[model samples]
Target: MATALSEEELDNEDYYSLLNVRREASSEELKAAYRRLCMLYHPDKHRDPELKSQAERLFNLVHQAYEVLSDPQTRAIYDIYGKRGLEMEGWEVVERRRTPAEIREEFERLQREREERRLQQRTNPKFSSRGIRPGLTTVLARNLDKNTVGYLQWRWGIQSAMNTSIVRDTKTSHFTVALQLGIPHSFALISYQHKFQDDDQTRVKGSLKAGFFGTVVEYGAERKISRHSVLGAAVSVGVPQGVSLKVKLNRASQTYFFPIHLTDQLLPSAMFYATVGPLVVYFAMHRLIIKPYLRAQKEKELEKQRESAATDVLQKKQEAESAVRLMQESVRRIIEAEESRMGLIIVNAWYGKFVNDKSRKSEKVKVIDVTVPLQCLVKDSKLILTEASKAGLPGFYDPCVGEEKNLKVLYQFRGVLHQVMVLDSEALRIPKQSHRIDTDG
Candidate 1:
């Protein structure tokens, strides 16, 4: 089992490379990978006692990496800042309150813990928990489709509430029942009933119904096309409401036509020839009511557009303010950088593992080191790697952008290893290692 560490502690790069797979790997693939690494690095495989210890150490590190990346929420955090980003809260919270040094410290602490476990795995394989559990759902429904005249729906799910209604009009009274099973990825249900009005005073009349009423099925999908934006599609059937309007926007582009009626009857026998769905409004006279309503609708649409634009403007303003604040924080960190001149230099690096057994008979070990520098590194009280080094380092690439970073550091100050986690832009000085009387020393 991997111990829990707050977002305030962990190394970002070790978090990413720790898993030994690309960021785009699927959840299942990630599991397979963890399993494979555990098998390969299990301490039992090492022939030499010392090598066995190394294998055990790396195994635990591998286990910790899998424990994090296997979980969706934790993986998201790791994806952002490698192992270090886990110190910060989940995706929604950014640690603007912490200093750069503080964030770095958090990341460093996580990194050290991971490394320590990596060292420990050499002899023992603690494969108790990988930090993943299966999630499930169930649904029941009948008459979920839509008809030209109106709607029919049925659905049931545990995550939703049940609803029932009865109404009595001048002509008839009927009961309606509805249930929504889940939120978003859940199930749904609906039911309908009908009863005739008094039959003694009028011509013969009957009511007929087969299933529920007014239910539509919908789903949304998204694909990323660029850095700052994404492509998405919404599919649905039924009455328009809430997110259902997304489908209406696509339907609006189609052509429309209505059927002609010549006979007098309570219900028209006319058909519609619209590209999408039918429009029931009839005649130039009916256009009168529709005209005013259309005008009012246009006004409403304009009002909505105005409101949306205002909201967009407000959102942009807020974003701009946040950007400015970050810039200020960056400047402050730079100023503070002058003090922690010789701190631990953290670098994010990436390298592709290549199996080049050219001999085809003997195993080979080849590790190409790639250093990625996005932030400055503190080493021995002097800034060795400046931010400018970021531009020159290969593979110092950031696996995730638009994510907060927290860093923790654990190292021996005198003779004992201590841990410190920091949020991005936060700072911490390593406590001086205490010297104790040692016969060996």
Candidate 2:
């Protein structure tokens, strides 16, 4: 049978229907029903692809229903709290003789905690920058004789200009104030200096620096260029002398500093240089840092989705098993009521062909007949029918390995006779007979 149930159907499943047993069935009866169902729907017995798939699914459902209904404790829990109740942690507490009120309180507490966590996650930020360090840099430089200049710089935030630094120099012993602006593809920096040197040739010096696309240019009454290439240049102006330009070119293994003085004594100097080079540092950072981080995040999300899917499947299975139990109880009640009212009863039922030493071509298929056996089993006082294997009856055999079969019961109440059909594995329930008085009689 293709017994895969939808979500709603699983919630309403009848365990009795799944096991084909009465609600009042004893443990032995339940086990027998489970075994029979297992044999009928075992995936290995089906040859068709679709039927085998369905059998595998149905086989799992049968096992689940049997596991719950067969356990005394779990079955009791299921009867009261249902699928959701069985999932509670208090189930273990039940074994320690905890009161129902205590168990309920614990469940409520867990629910509240879960809700609070969810709300906190939604209302609060997922990512925060509290107490996080921003940026850091260290510089070390030595002057010609014994003089040295070095500093440590630190800045924080992308849009804000916040920085603190400590400077060391022989001729100057004063603090510096700086402002900076950074955006995508561009950045700018401005700084004011107050030197405490005795000369005071330039006590207050200001500098402005800007860069775009790896090309940096600076000015402080003297123009400088830190080009995308390995060459750097700075221009300085003197009072008596004209303009003096200094260029530094970095080669594979050495750096050449060329200072050309274009005073009133020399000719004007104009220079132009350009080259295309690879952004190896940027590519290396993406390969080593950003790419791996993004990949890890994607894998984590995929794992979470897989876990959620597994949880959903498990919940559906539990609901399906619970549905079967409910259905069994319903059918059991119906059978008991029919039997108590002295209504029709089922005897031997046949669902396949019957051969009577007859013609070779004669065959019966897809039909059930129980008229003769029911007539013989009925009594004037009372009727009783014990559950038996449907295939054990004479002139009966399973037609196909995974084919569905049903039973036809011959019933008579008062003087009206009727035939009712039901799944061969289902409990029998007879319809109520209506009595009418004849005017002539």
Candidate 3:
């Protein structure tokens, strides 16, 4: 029920839809869209009172969406947590850096917790709703100064108990000491973890737990053998229950548990999730979610890096423009010569990053018309660029700076429309029938 509400809330409002723009639209794109919409719906532009009022409303909405989505900070929150995030309180404190998916996860968790509390309120007295988890729900209270939290828990049908724990969280490990009453069976756990990389790409862990029932010690080591799966083994010993070993093969949230008893007295048990229990869950989550989130974050970082180097890129673009200016006279001569005798005429040429999709892209996409440069390169009704980067050419620039590039050409060979796309580091040979854009060859 809570999950459904959260999903519904997520789909509620979209700023991109209001702006009639893609979510990936840049700041310049947002401004252009806002201006265009503003011009079309300026209220004063309409003569009829009803039409003016309607335009006013639309203009207000467009302005509001533009205001929220234009600011970088608010836009980031809007992108991650939706429109409500812009109005939410805790989000104001942007102290910690988090990914979009991470922020969404936190926001959803808070919403779920809030829903749980709401359910708690309308239930037990009227018994209308039983909360989310069905059991004794969640956190009763917490003292942040002392780093302690209290919990009331219920088991089976009627078993009830309560406990309070003070926690210590550090960079490397977590320690918690809990005190319980009412038929208390004192329990404690200690874990050790060693990591090879700073980001914890490879790790080994061991833990010991002691309770009224028995004392159990577990030892395990896990390594990520592939992007999707982790290879790990754990050996555990319990005083009364005996010893067992487990081999865990976990990949993309699919869990495999194998438990093999080391002692004959212990008997054969399930093969998975021994002491490697929590670790398997971690890897499953990392593979299924964390990988994609990290990849997206990396792309964002690269974009930011590119933005920071805009000055250098701009300078290079100026140089390329100057080179193009120098070749304009020769290019015009080539075009006239081609048109005079039905030779290949460079109709239009764009050099830079391009998408594979057939839909029209934003005007702000990193692309520049290199028609002049390309026209000058044409010879004998054919244009052939060498097997090297075109960026080093006299009249070409790396429009996208640090990104892969493509050369899209629309040319008329024997007065027929034809187009070809050539990759940045690949050779280009044109005037071929494969690039024809007409029914008649």
Candidate 4:
């Protein structure tokens, strides 16, 4: 049965009814609806080349709507406020068109700012973003003739990333390197730090040798945790490797200082926290933006290395075509396997969050991205459905507990029509439920 259209959908027309779903539907209902419509309207499943683009646009809209409304909170906000809530919340929503002149001006301004920061650091070394006098600061004092003498050593190891704190009161170059020296027995340490490449991302940093000759390095990745906030984690190594950890917390803020605009600052009360098993500690706040473009460049170089491997293999005089093929296949598998090792969303993503702490949540996401291989999609849906129905065939699980769900399979079974849904926890198999599906040209 077709669902009723809401007031907003009625006014918008244009398949808007097909996009927004009823808020009261269960998770399974929503998923079923999405999977059904996606397969039915998928442009790739159609042959009329002219209709392909139009179908693609509609598919994208439906997919986007499902992504938002499938989540409870986002659906509520959209229902009450429509697109306005998304805009105010900094969502990746469409914006009003900007004039050509305005667009050019914005780009120019960004370029100028980048150049200015680069020049400023070169000329005035001490003018750090964190507002600290660069260079070394030390003190030598004697106790009131107490038959002993005392001295103090204080050094501000300012380089780049650390030169500016999150407080906006400082200016940072890209990275920061620092070293300190005081009393040989106690005051000596070395430290290094860097921030994330993206502003809406997390900051990573580390410090070690602590007093004058310690080494520290850290890496951080950003993820959206909730509507109003973002979260991330970092791994580090150094002199204080197991002892010291830096916590960076940043928040967004906007004010009417001049023309309307948006900006973010490190909250004054922002807490810097770190824990060593049972211990917990906190410090005051600060801010800065790290760049990731450099990392992408390095990855490109790695790609070149992979491409060059085949040439190296070919150089062997005894090499055979079979050996070359085997090497290539092995390399492909290695690259895919590495995804699970790095805990990223690529090769091993189908394993459902192998490295994630929350297994259930990750598994649900992974299921959505597992497209049926093209070979299966070209056959009969009934056979595919029956095969997918096997319960203990491995790789299948009730990822979302308490929900009666089915895998809306779309694949080939014996070179015939294949599109079906099945419920099999051990092996999600699908069988043709109706004769409506068409898997031919």
Ten residues in sequence with the least summed lDDT for candidate 3:
1-10
lDDT of 2 by residue, 209-287 (tens): 4445332222221111111124344544433344555656565567787777656322334212111011243347547
Tens-digit lDDT track of model 3 for 1-441:
001113322234445644445567888978976885576567786676866666676678678889988876677787766676677887656624665566667778887666545434422111112443434533454434322233344332232345454444323443445544323355665665666654435667777878787888778777765457776778777877677887787889897888787663443352244444556676797788866786776577666766666676676577567556545656787888999989999889888777555634753466888888778767678776655667655457667655677888999988888999888767788899999996654
State TM-scores per candidate: 0.21, 0.26, 0.40, 0.21
What candidate 2 gets wrong by more than 4 Å, as runs, is: 1-10, 95-417, 420-441
TM-score, candidate number 3: 0.40
Candidate 3 contains a number of clashing pairs equal to: 6
Clash pairs for candidate 2 = 13-323, 13-324, 14-323, 14-324, 14-327, 15-324, 15-325, 16-328
lDDT of 1 at 224: 24
Q: Candidate 3 — which pairs collide?
A: 257-271, 257-272, 258-271, 258-272, 259-270, 259-271
* Residue 35 lDDT (model 2): 81
Model 3 residue 297 distance off true place after TM-score fit, in angstroms = 2.9
Question: Top model by TM-score, which number?
Answer: 3
Q: Lowest-scoring 10 consecutive residues by lDDT in candidate 2?
A: 270-279
